[model samples]
Target: MLRTDYKPQSIRQSGQLLQRHSSRGFRWAFTGTIIGILLVILSFNSGSLADSHASQLSTEKNKISAEPAQQQLSADKAKASIKKLPRMNIELPPDTDGRLSQDQTDIADEYENAFPRRALPLSIETSLYDESADDENPNTLTAVTVQAGDSLARIFQKQSIPARDLQNIMSLGKPVKALTKMMPGTVIEFVRDRQNTLIQIRYPLDETDTLIIDKKASGYHSKIDQVKVETELVSVNGVINDSLFLSGKAAGLSDNLIMQLAGIFGWDIDFVLDIRKGDRFTVVYEKRYAAGEFLGNGAIVAAEFVNQGKSFRAVQFVDDKGNRNYFTPEGYSMRKAFLRAPLNFLYVSSGFKRKRFHPILKRVKAHRGIDYRAPKGTPVYAAGDGKVIRSGYNKYNGNYVFIKHGEKYVTKYLHFSRRKVRTGQRVKQGQTIGYVGMTGLAEAPHLHYEFLVNGVHRNPRTVKLPQARPIDKKHRTLFTASTRSLIARLDLEDRIYLAQLDRINRQQAALSNSEISPKSAPQ
Candidate 1:
């Protein structure tokens, strides 16, 4: 009835140990072996022992392939259950270029992560969300560049902006009126909502200044925002090759800075009449910057102009009153009492002569003053600070303005298209008093300027001009202390030039020495 005990080696070893221990009891061990042999013979005939052995061998050999069928059946049931679930085909909003924008991508990522795919909601939408969710206005800034012949009203109309809004903005007066006169290439930015109501506007006043206008609860409010710009000292040395303007351009000075340079020395040296070849100049000025970007050039800090072998140096200084002006090292004002030419005219059409035939009178008469030909509407300025003694119309002289500078000098301007000053009005030097035009007694648009001394006509160009006020004694110390460093900076140009020349000379000397050494070597 005993089943198979499958430990054959242990059973054999146990039998040997029994034989060793029970050597005297061989009869009993032999009898037990005979009984075990008889039992094994009976078990071999019966198939139960062989079946148990085969089952053990088959399980050990097929261990990798063998698994419970119930687990696989459960997996199949799970797949079937998942397939029975509802399939969802969600439609997304059309993208501009067949690809999602950054906003859409962010929304998609959030939706994908927040809800499970199998348990997705009926629909998840992202199109209605604002592109800039954090911004209160959530409006895009639209840029409108001013083109030629474009007006503020025209731009607004072209962009479909409201005319009433422009009118309301203009009602704010002169400060807002500046936007109407923006030149071509100026860019104006407008921020508007979906309804196209202007939320904000920005116009660049200059490189570092932006005029900002925003819609407020009460009304529209405007303010100027100035970016911090760094100022750096710069210097340029240029010699006259052909013309002062060209030389200034070669020196890397812009047109505005060149005009400023000429103005600094214009009192003493006339750029048109007196500037000659070989004249040289050195300018130390300000270079402005903001956030490592070059904004533009600033004022002339100090300058030296050598005209006709005469050297003149001017240093820019600010007084205790915060008034800035250029002066010589000896504290003399660079500005003169009168400018050479009141208007920046094209040329002197007719020089002051003793006798000449009048173009309009058609008779030989003494032409006592210089006539400056310029475009109509060119602004004519006062030559010196004075009170307007006479301002009226005449048959011989169209629109005239006469200014009496003290008791000694009286200046007259004739043939103006318009007059800006009134009689007995005090006007500063260089103040625009009228515009050039061809009216009564003039064949063309020109300014007939006259300089009178003691009520007698004198040459406007050759007359000696009065000197401007010098540095006041009270402010001399402040001006002197401020100009020392600027003077040194001006002098640095010459020092640097001399150092370059010295370096070149030394290199030439070294080259000559090397050549002479080869020639004079021992043979």
Candidate 2:
């Protein structure tokens, strides 16, 4: 502690102290600079890593966005290929499970066995004839040809058969009345065994076929094989102006086809009254054939009718339950409870009225009947099923006829051109009774029609008709089954047609939007 103010005396000592302090400060500064440099590098590296991660996320988002587009493009290409492919035409087998195999074999065998393999030898022919003559049994084959107006009963009578056997055979089902209705020009063959009993009875049902009945211990058994034919689609179009029959003829359609069309729309519209001019219609239907020969038109598969600017379309279809009913897009039945007119007639001239001027009497009188206007000689039809009660001429009414329909219904027709039916004659619904003429005190050529319920006159135009009975409970099951199949068939046809239309529309849209040249389109 002596001489406390004394500073360092040696320069070297002062220099050493200064150098040590500088070194320590320099070390601390160096450490701080190194830490700052490391922090800067770490910040740059972290920023670079974040940028890479962002870029990878952006690339993943882009791929995800393009995946749906790529899939859609692939699907479009597949659809194009499918559209370009040829349509497949599959022909189903004639028989589903070889039902005709046995029949076919039997037919072939019968043809092969038509003639005996060996004829009787001349040496044995004399012995056979002598043995046959000595024996009580007759060995002969009789062939009978059916002529016009000849029936099975007449043929049997000619053959001298026992009446008791005929009666027994007829009692099985239908009597000779049913069998006698057979067409003429058919041949029948009978073969007798050694016991003189009928061994076989064969007859030609038609020109190309024959049916055989064989005697058995259980009675008689017969085999009948019907020939089925394939049919093709036929399309027809027409415009109805006057009558359905005339329109069908003009359109090159058959009467049966016209009737079927009327039946299809009968439930919704009355063909007798609702038909108007310019009503157009188109039908795609089927025709039946047998052995490459035309039979007739079968049914209407699809149809379109444009009536008074309104269009109605229907497709034949069978459903799962087999209930056949024409429906709208919403599945509403087209059929109502009853038909508008039982007899689809022409036009109505005079309607029902309480008081009307009599044409002949020239005075106001009660008009109880509906008058239909038609050309003279136009046939009049029966409104319903009934029996003819009266057919005669009168002073006020020219040539008239009265028909008793059911227990509670009666109808009358007056001023006819002529009477074709007689009293006590059974008439069916829509049966033509006579022509239209001014035979009575009518102003013009017209038909006077009347409907009576329990002998009281009713307004024919406004009368409320009774509904047809529904299917019987016993037949409901069968009806439902059959209807479902038919409905399904109709539905399939409709779907196919709609799909075809959609494809056409899509093709048209593509043609409008695409850059493909018109020459590339299918011709």
Candidate 3:
């Protein structure tokens, strides 16, 4: 053997030398060979034991069949403290003679045991560096109802929420002020975390609007969430048997709708004195809905009233400026120049007479105005678009209001319990000026209504007043377009209602015939 000085080989050289060996260097390599085999066997045994131990410890931890290469590398870096899961060098034996197992079940089993699988997260966000997550997760949702004498500060204090938070939220602006002005029975929603810090708030402005305030990392944020309301046209028809209110109720109409119906036809017909038996009306109105939930009726789209064999039709028209008013099909305004009576009357307590015995004075005098008996505090309207020329009290007419409608017309309202307007204030027709009351020279709560033409007292009920302004020329086109479809639908609905009424009458007639006998054949 040639003399050769021993030089230690590196790990790379040793790995290459293991693949091919020579007999001259067998002694020095024998110990290294035995130690490498022992290490390989110890690694497999430790892996098996570590696998069982990890499974025992992390029974509740999420498990995955295949570990990602990145995590496996991480596991390798931490192998000193953790269990070693390195791949082995042993060659897997064939299952059959010169034939490898196609299924490789044995190899798969060894591979599964060879590495320590990490408990993979079941979540998709597996990033190790996402530190901006919210610490306060609002979980508890509370809806605090506003009661009488409750302020926003008190509400927040009651909820155990910091008043500072409420102040911070209110700093967001006008939309947030809606919360501070919550009415009785309104709801204010709050979202808080486990630590009881308020994260969000919602204040409903109306049926179709809500103000939302949210807590962000920077500061409190707010936005208005306006809910879209659906408008559905609904038609209701009824015959006046006893009263319009009774008939409307039976026809499934709300008091608001019933009042609206009376108002629409009030210019043409006197609802108090003109609504009689055989009177029928058909109304197409707007029914509002928010998120499929009923909100309320909006406006009367079209209405038809047959009073005393005379049919009065009116359709609501909205112009481009969003101003809405009722008008006839010919574009004449349905609102007259003046209301027949300044206040709603229950009955005619006294008529205008030249020589009428005064109840309080016990003397005969010329009663200048018609006395309309109504409930005390009932509103008194202006009756015409005018200015308040005089508003004062007197011995004869207490709390009197005299309005000058142009130079030719004047209207007066007397015996007011409460005056709502001041003198020299320009007032519109139907504007409330005062409330009905029994004042000087009055025996009961009634409105003494008078209409004067050129300073001469005239009958408010039978006088021919000036006409209301017609629809503007620019709005005529839009009004015609909007009302055209509504008018057609109104007519169709009216016809359908008439047919239904006729069918009902026929059914009743047949029932009457069935109920009646032929007088026993005149026996």
**Predicted model with the maximum lDDT:** 1
lDDT of 1 by residue, 200-303 (tens): 88999888889898888888888889999999998899888888889999989899989988888888887777778878899888999999999888999999
Give the CA lDDT, 0 to 100, for residue 17 in model 2. Answer: 89
Instruction: Give the range of the ten consecutive residues with the poorest summed lDDT in model 1.
Output: 115-124
Task: Name the regions of candidate 1 deviating beyond 4 angstroms.
Answer: 1-137, 147-175, 193-197, 217-219, 319-322, 346-350, 353-365, 373-378, 392-395, 417-426, 435-445, 472-477, 495-523
Name the 10 consecutive residues with the lowest summed lDDT in model 2.
114-123
Q: Give the per-residue lDDT digits (tens) of candidate 3, residues 150-232.
A: 99999888888877787787787776777767799998898876667788888888888888888999999998899889999
Candidate closer to the true structure by TM-score (higher is better), 1 or 2: 1
Report how far residue 418 has shifted in candidate 1, in Å: 5.1
Global Cα lDDT for candidate 1:
0.84
**In terms of TM-score, which candidate is strongest?**
3
Off by over 4 Å in 3: 1-139, 160-181, 193-199, 214-223, 497-523
Which clashing pairs does model 3 show? none
Measured with C-alpha atoms, the lDDT of residue 109 in candidate 3 is 65
Clashing pairs in 1: none
Between prediction 2 and prediction 3, the one with superior lDDT is 3
Better of 1 and 3 by lDDT: 1
